[model samples]
Target chain A: MSVLIFAELDEGALKKSSLEAIYYGSKVAALTGTSTTAIVLGEGNADELAKAGRFGATKVLHASDAQLNEGNAMAYASVVAEAANQEGADVIVLAKSSLADSMAARLAGKLKAGLAANVIELPDVSSGFRVKRSIFTGKAFAFTELTAEKKILAIKKNTITPEETEATATVEAFKPALNDTDFAVKVTNVEKATGDILLPEADLVVSAGRGLKGPENWGIVEDLAKALHAATACSKPVSDLDWRPHHEHVGQTGIKISPNLYIACGISGAIQHLAGVNSSKVIVVINKDPEAPFFKSADYGIVGDVFEVLPRLTKAVQEL
Target chain B: MKILVCVTSVPDTITKITLTDNNTKLNKAGVQFITGPYDDYALSRAVELKEQLGGTVTVLNVGESDADPVIRKCLAIGADDAIRVNAEPTDAYFVAEQIAAIAKENSYDLILMGRESIDYNGGQVHGIVGEMLGLPSISPVMKLAVEGTTAKITREIEGGHEELEAGLPLVLGCQEPIAEWKIPNMRGIMSARTKPLKVVEATGKDTLTHITNYELPPARGACKMIPASEAETLIKLLRTEAKVI
Candidate 1:
């Protein structure tokens, strides 16, 4: 049973979450005594995708199709299904990003395979494949058993650390038969954050809530985040108030993240908010109110004004 | 025009999550159940589209009879009718098949569901249903507007968002800001009791996946407080002690 990793590219660079998927898929392949393969699609840099060999992918298949530059779910699913058949892959892995998840859904239907999304761990494939996944917005976990010959798995972000090995992969090009109808929905325009790190892949995150006062005072949070090289986030209320983009909202109704270090400022931590970031390795809370519920869950608490403390913290990190 | 919105009853966001029965199932004791928050956007949009296009909005659920109250709430919120498939949804594939079969029978103009459920986090049903019915499916759509038989959708891609257009007989997995949630009024609540609710047996078979058990996440450790004046000390701890910075 060969393992296949679907590495989705973000503006020519591989998504950081894809690296984690490759690392995890390769380990699963090794556990099952099979070679690992990665399928690269769209207008991504082939050399970068081939770097998956360092993460345990022994083979990389790149489909350099201009028509697939703006990927469509149905078309990509068909292409991935063909590649999986060609590679003799019984298990397919993908990063649980929104687009890959969309494609994964179509791929499951096309392959008539069972799919388990938001998987956090590899399966015990010695018998039937059994894996663990987060449910209820990371408040609890569910162990799922997939009793199927062919299965598709989407790995949640930050679940696995990439281990780079000394290896080079043989990059090969493969093409699948596709038609204009495959591009059912034509993309008209795109808006992006350009160079900013994606929230899901950030190792360090600097988040704020209403405690920051208003959008005008966000400069301090941005300054501290810049000093620490972390992605920015906000509470649900902040997003609801339009203080930040909806994508940056972190809570039960927003993006669930598990960064290595999460620094929350001025945010009164609600259970819905905690549901998103509780999985972080270390949490630091800075708020004026010491009784804030977030402080109870924090690894370190500092009772102070974010306005005064943020500048000092930024300067201190720079001095170090 | 006919529209169907899929609603899921999930544990409320504030529910204290726990495990029961040897950690094989969720402990429902004292838990409050509500319609999935994301799905509220889809349901509200369905009701809005129904009002504008002079059509009927129907709510669909794959759950036991206990879910009837939730369906009625959705009806009160503005749906014209409801359909409850009498079965416990095991996985996305099982639920999608039931939806696809129902849609095939009804031939609705549009089918909408939340991008994902808060409980399972499986955002697979919309795409599976679309593929099964051979229709166009767009997910994570933030903005949707209909004109005649075409629908303009704003969907999120990796690191960016895109605007796309597709024809009717489509599936949309909705997210935030697509449509504001609408609350049920006293008049609507009273009318919901008289609205028609059709209960049908599930027609799909469970495939490929089953939950073996469930477990609560480990509890957090006690927090350690630090002085507000010690910025340099905290930075030092983050570096040498935490080794994270």
Candidate 2:
């Protein structure tokens, strides 16, 4: 038996999260006594794809097709299902990133496989496939069992610590059938600023809320983010007031991020917002109110004005 | 144009979550329920689109009859009608099947819903329904503009947003700044009671995944208060103690 891991590429390169996923799949493959194979659909060369070996994959199937240039969930699922069939993979692993969850869901349906999304741990494949996941907005955990012949697990990013090994993978060419129906959504334009650390994948995050006052006062937050090479995020109210982009909003109703360090400036921690960010390994809060709810959940708390504390913290980080 | 919007009712954000029946079920007693905050944006956007583009917005819920107030709120926010599938949504795939069945039966040009419910936070239904119905799906769509038979959609990618063009018969999972949250006026509230609220029996299907138990995350320790003047110390701690910087 083989374990198939979907290794999505960004601009002809493997992403940090994808590498973590490969590492996770490799660990689980070891437990199951099965070899791990990575399936790359989009850009990247075979030599680069074989680098997945360091993360536990023994074989990399490169589906080098022009039609697979852009992401289409239906077509991606079709290719993944075909790859699973060709490799005789009983367990499929995918990263629970944007568009990947949808692709995994569709593949689960297409293959009649039991799907477990947001999986945080590897299953006991020695017996039945069982996994753990966060539920109730991170307030609770749930143990799930997949009963189907095939199991698809979309592992959450940053949930697993990656380990590099000496194993290298062999690259192979893969081709899957495609149809016009897969091209329903057409890409009109793709716009992304070249080199900014995205919030979803950042190791450190600096966030501000209404306490920052206005959009004009975002300089200190940006400076701190720049000094630490971290991503910037905001509370829901800040995004609602158009002080920041909605994509930067991290709350229950917005983007949920799990970073190594999350610094909140001038934001009172609400349960909704905490539900999104409480998963961070370390949280630091800066607020004038000592009784701010965010402080209760923070590892470190500073009761001070954000305008003063933010600039000073930025300067200190710069000195470091 | 006919637009279909899917909504899920969830416990209010402040509700203390507890599980019962050996941790297999959520204890619903005395818990306050509200329309999902993210979904409100979708329903409001659907109403806004219907007003601007001339379409009938229909709300669909794969939930039990207890979700009437939430469905009525969708109507109050300007959905022309609502449909409730009388089934407890057990899993994401089951809910997706219910939505796909409803969408297939109706001739909706556009399907809309929140990116994910705050409760389960699955974020899988939109794409699953779209794939089941053989339509394109765009998720966490932050910007949408409909003109003629095409809609321009913008969604956040890894670093920034990607602008795309999709024809009718598409599913869109919406989030904030796409449309502002709409409050129901007095007239709308009164009319909401008169709006069509159809309840249908469940069309059950095979479920592949099951949750066996539930447990809460470990509580975090107390915060270490730092004086405002110790900014450099805090940075040093972050580097050495936290090892985050």
Candidate 3:
């Protein structure tokens, strides 16, 4: 039996989440006493996929197709399902990011396999493949077992730390049958933000709310984030008021993040907003109002005007 | 064009999560259930689209009898009819199987659902159903428009966004940028009582994933406060004590 992992790539480079998946897939392969192979869609450097061997992959299947450059959920799912069938893979793994979840679910249905999504821990293969996942907005955990012959799993991002080992894996080119309908959804244009850290992938996050007063005072938050090498985020109200872009908004109505550390400045945490960041390992809240709801959930709290507190914090971080 | 929008009942966002003594089941004493927020967006968007395109809109909920109130609420909001799968939602896989069965028997032109249910947040149903029925699935969609048999959608990417075009027989996982939610009017609420709500037993595969138990996260530490005047000191503290900076 072989384990097949879907390696995600953007503009021909592997994403960090894909690396994490490779690590988890490698472990599963080791536990099952099976070989691990990686399948990449579109044009990716074979050398990069082969490097996944450090994480347990014995081979990399690079499916290079010009039409597959842009992500089409149906097409991607078809390709992965076909690759698994061709390789006789018993298990298929992917990162639980937007693209992977979308494709994994569909692939499971196509293969008539069992699916485990948002998995946070490695599987226990001694019995059946039992995986652990978060439920109810990180309020609870669920341990599940795959009962079907084929299994598909979407591993959560940043859940598993990547460990390295030395090995050289072979790279092979595979082609899947495609048609016009497979590319029905044509990506007309692509837009990317100009920043070093993407909020979803950032380990440390520095966020602000309406408490910052206005856009003019944002420099302090930005400075602190830069010094800490953290991505900047905003509450819904700030994004609604146009102080920050909607993409930077993190709340129940926005993106849900579980960074290692989340620093909130001038933000009064509402339950809706808390539902998003409650998964952070550590939370620090800075608000002038001592009774702000955010403080209740914070591991550390600072009761002060963010405008004054942020600059000082920025300077201290600069010194460090 | 007939649009079928699926909704799921989920725990309220602010509900305090607690586990049963065994750790395998959720403690439901203080938990209040509500319609999944993402489904609300899908319902509202479908209603608006039907209004503009002159079509019928139906809301489907795959859950036990307790979901009737929310299913009625969907009808009040503008859905022409409602369908409640008479079964406890075992898992995403089981739920998708039920929805796919309904879609196939009904022949819906378009299927819409929230990106994921808040309770489980698996984000799997739309894609699974699409695959089951051989349809295109677009997720985390910010913009959508229907013209004849084609749909134009804008999907959210990591840094920015990407626009795509797909034909009919498609599935869309609606998110925030779809449209503003509309509250039900008194007239609609009154008329919802008379709308037909069909409840059917679930049919298809068994759940592959089962919950072992629920666990509440550890409580947060006490808040720390620094005077507004000592902002710089707080920053220094973060650099040294907190180490975040």
Candidate 4:
């Protein structure tokens, strides 16, 4: 009866969400009177893997398989299940990353574990294991009880805070038996969007909507985001119009974000849009229409033309 | 090519989510149900592939009679036929099991669905079904083109996207940019009335997890409105008062 955390990496470093999952697993281990083990299924720095203990894991296992580095869900699931079995783990914890989304279900199916995904809080294990999670794309929440003997939790990002300690984990090499069929899906090419803060992990995000008018008017939004060192996002209509890439669209059907601060320019708050961003710590709406639905949900608001207000806000952040 | 596309009915995106039945169920009164927005992308792409590759496109749903209209909508949009597993899709695994059972009975070359259903937002069905059938499951697919038995796919990751190649008997969870949403034409709508709609009993009944309760997020406080000319002051407020930036 132990907790196993899958420590995912970004550029050979542990992702912030994965660190939080380590902490989350440790907390669950403490509650259940068990130890926590962190496993890196792919290539990762040995020194960085050892730091999993700082986030509360008791030990770290490095698979160090180059084939596992690419986002291959089937192969990843096989390795994770093997690691869990070897560690005698009944609880598997993972960050709700795209990688996790792709593999967690496969892992659950392989291990016959009950999975609670998009979990936002630690489980209440007083009786049956119940976990709170965001549902309906952040419009509502649900408390679900896992009834299976083994449990899998894919926790949402920016929800759990990671605490560090002075301890370093003992790192050991681990090899999991693999099946050839697991590598059927071949990753032919990898293209990473460069030079901008990744929206999912960005602390602050600056977004605009249709009111920006055209693609050329996006300079002001970019300027504001650059000044604040924030990621840029746009509404669904903007993406639908080809004014921005679909990846930059933030809405119920698009990328949902819960940053520390979210600034919206010239965007009326539709429920679809609000569903994605209502979880932000602070929301600022800048729209010409005072009656724009966004103001009702904003922490701070300004009724003004985006063309005028965005530059002023950019200058202010740059000055700060 | 025989493509099986799974879809579900969700509360309209604009519907204000409300709880009823002692907070254990969603309030359906006055709520309009529509095809899951993300699933539309999957259906459209599947239809496009069938047009290009000379194959049959079938729509599948794990739901009760309430989902018939939504499944019919898919047929109207160019799905040759439809199947509804007569059961409530109460859990992700349960739904996946039903899908896997159907896929086994009929060897679908490719299976597609939304990245996740809007209602549960589990995003787990494709992987689970893929594992159950020993097929490759790639999700949030933004671009997919098929040639012979191979599929050229691009999927969204955290920061960017990845291009991949997979043989048939693949499961993909699709999203936008795969293809534009196809609205039902008048001719298609007329023919949809005569399309084959098969209703099958659900094979999987056990749900590993159950929701104990539903909750609405806390309400927002009053907005602190700043004058248009004093937009910079809002930044100071964000720094000192909100302290987020």
Candidate 5:
């Protein structure tokens, strides 16, 4: 028995979420009495690929085809399925992301594997292989059992804590059979967000709603985000009004995030908004309304006006 | 272009999540259902494309009769027709198999769906269907435009976006900014009453997974109130007590 983990790369560097997956996979391998092997596709530095060992993989398989870097779901799934077969893996683990989820769907179909998406906890091997996952957009949880011979898990980001080791993985060159059909989706251009943290991957997030009034008042939110090196997000109304980009909206109808710290300013906690961020580890709500529904779900609360509270909070963060 | 857009009927986002039947099923007593928010984007884009490209848009749902009204809403929003696979949509693989079987029979020129259903949030059907049909799939597509037989797509990625091109007969999982959600006009709603709604039996029976139990997340303790005048202390608490920074 073996575990195969897909360590996806972003612009030639291993992603933090991928490292977390390797660590999570190693724990599963220990429970199953198997070894963990990490398969890395696309173009990446050899040294960076070897960091898989630092997170817990015993071996690293590097598939260096340039076409693998295109983010084609079908092609990536084919390569991952091939790696799983070659490694004789019974379980495949991956970090949850748009790219990973897309590939996992095809991987499940190709391998006939039982896939559990958005898995939040390690499987309970004490009984059957059961996994707990978030459902209803993180409003509830479901314990699901995989009934297939092969299994795939797409674990939610930031759910597991990773540990580093001094160990080194034995890197091996792996070349999966490829053809022109594998590159069916042709990538024309790539535009990467420069300098700003992406909300989905952020650890700390500063968010607001209509309470900030207009788009011009966003400087306060941005100031706090810059001080803490966090990402900026808004409630649905802010995005709907075009005060912020739709991508920056975090709510039931927008991007769902589980950042370690989520600071909401001037936003009333509508049930829809809470569904998107209720899973956040620590929530701080700053609202003038004392009866705001968001305060009930918050770890901390400040009853005050946004105009007065935000600048003070930004200064406090800067002082720190 | 013949477009197939798959949608899911989910409890409104404002509804509190509650499970029944010994915690194995969602309680539907008073819950109102709507098209999955992400799927609404896909349906809107499909309608827009059909208008610009001059084609028919058919919406499909893998659910029981409870989803018929939701599927009709799709038609009211300008879908040419509708299909509902008669099943409970228990597993992601099972749903994908049904969709793939239907797609094989129809041979749609383009397939679209939301990134994932809001209830299950699997986000897996599109690629699984594409794989089963031997077609390429792009997911969480934010922007899509078709010229001739080629589609220029911009998909969301971690930290940024990527622009790609692919031919027709492809599957795409769409999200926001692809198109605005379309509300049904009076004429559209009236015409939907007569639109063909096909009901089909599911061909797939093998479910790879099952929910063993359900759980609600633990309720948080009372919020520790911090005075606005002493906002700096909150940061200190975050640093020293929470240790997040």
Candidate 6:
């Protein structure tokens, strides 16, 4: 038995989240006394996938089918399930992104395996493969154990620390059993945003809210994010008001992010917004109002005008 | 275009979470429940699709009788009917099994749900259901349109989005920016009282995962106040102590 990991890719390179999954799967494989094999879907550099050996993958399964490049959860799940069965894997691991979560769920059902999602910690194999995960909008956590013969886990991005090692793993191309019907959904066009950082995988996040005053004043937020090499996020209201795209919204009604450090500028720390970001390791809030609710949850607080605070913060960061 | 929208009842987003006396269960004191926010988008979108295409929209939930009120709320939002699988959501896998069973029985042309429920935030149900029914599933969909037997969906990708076209019998995990949510009206609320809400025993397999205990996250440290004029000091603190820069 081995651990099968889905190594996610984008624009022909392994995504940062996949590295976390690889590290996580490798740890699980070590605990279970099994090897870790990575499956690469979509178009990506084969050499980079083989380099996943640094994170503990013993081998890489490269499915280079053009049809597999565009994601369809059912198709991806079917292929992964078949690969798991063929390799006699006891555990299947994936990132907890929307795409991975859907595929992991379906793969679990197809394999009739035990599945866990949004897992933050590696399981203790001695105690029936128990893992810890956040629930209730990061409000609580539960330590769960999978009892089925086959277990599947979706690891949250940035939660697991990726350790690097030196080992050259072999890469082999494996063709999954798929047909035209499996491609029920076909991709007609691909539209990608031009940016250096993806929000979900970002380690540092700089977010703005209505405190910026208006969309024209968003330069401070953007400049701060650029100086910090962070992704830019906004409050739900900002996104609702069309100041930012919906994907950039981070809150209870938006994307929940747990970056290493989250700097909030102008956001008042609404409870809904807190539900999404309270998981960040360190939180810094910049607001003119000392009574802003976000201050209660912040690891650091700056009671000042964002217009003045952000430029200074950005300058300071650039100096660093 | 018969659309099936699945909604899950979960703890309110702001509810203070606590473990029960047994540690294996959640504490219920003062906890309020509501329909998962993601599901609201899915339900509203399904209602919109039904209105545009002139089709029946049904809402499904996998929960106990306590979830009936939320199910009725879905009906009030214009779902023609409802189904409540009379079982505690054991886990994502089990819940997906229940949904898949219902979907197979009904043969819905389109299946819709939130990307993930707030309580568990598994984000696996749509994918699992699609796999079980051998149908296409697109998640984190930002835009969707129906034309004849095909669905034009704009899927949210990293940094950008991808547009795809799929036939009927597809699953979509609706996210934000899909559409504006609609509130239930008096007429719909009254009509919901008479809508059919069928409760069926769960046919899910034994739950493979078991929660050993619930734990709250470590308390955050006290906030350190940095003077607005002393921005340089704050930046130095971040670079040296915080080491985030």
Highest DockQ model number: 4
Winner by lDDT between candidate 6 and candidate 5? 5
Error of 2 at A133 (Å): 0.8
Candidate 1 residue runs with Cα over 4 Å from true position: B158-160
- Tens digit of per-residue lDDT, candidate 2, span B1-245: 89998998999999888889988878899998888887888888889988998979999998888899999989998999999999988887788888888887988988999888878777778877887887888887888889988999998776667888888878988887788899999999999999999999878677878888888788889888889988678899998998988
Off by over 4 Å in 3: B221-245
Lowest-scoring 10 consecutive residues by lDDT in candidate 3 chain A?
A179-188
Higher-scoring candidate on TM-score, 1 or 5: 1
Interface RMSD of 3: 2.0
State in Å the error of residue B120, model 4.
Answer: 0.5
lDDT of 5 by residue, B1-245 (tens): 99999999999888888889998877889999999999999999999999998989999999999999999899999999999999999898898999899999998988999988899889888888888898888888999999998999998876668899999889999998899999999999999999999999999698999898999899998899999888888999999998998
Model 1 agreement with the true structure over A1-320: per-residue lDDT tens digits: 58999987777877788888989999889888998898888777756866788877888888888877766787888899999999889999998886788899988887878898878887887778898988888888888988777789898877787888888777888888886666878788878787887888889999999998799999999998899989999998898899988888888877888888999999989999998998898899999998899988888889998998889989998998
**TM-score, A chain, model 3:** 0.93
Candidate 6 CAPRI classification by DockQ:
medium
Provide per-model DockQ scores: 0.76, 0.68, 0.66, 0.79, 0.77, 0.75
Count clashing residue pairs per candidate: 0, 0, 7, 0, 0, 0
Given candidate 3, what's the lDDT at residue B39? 89
Better of 1 and 5 by lDDT: 5
Tell me the TM-score of model 3: 0.94
Give Cα-based local distance difference scores for all models: 0.87, 0.86, 0.83, 0.90, 0.90, 0.85
Grade the docking of candidate 3.
Answer: medium
Query: Native-vs-model 3 lDDT?
Result: 0.83
Could you estimate the TM-score for every candidate? 0.98, 0.96, 0.94, 0.97, 0.96, 0.96
lDDT over C-alpha atoms for residue A106 of model 2: 73
The total number of steric clashes, by the backbone 3 Å criterion, in model 5 comes to 0
Candidate 1 chain B, poorest ten consecutive residues by summed lDDT: B156-165
Q: Between 4 and 5, whose TM-score is larger?
A: 4
lDDT of 6: 0.85
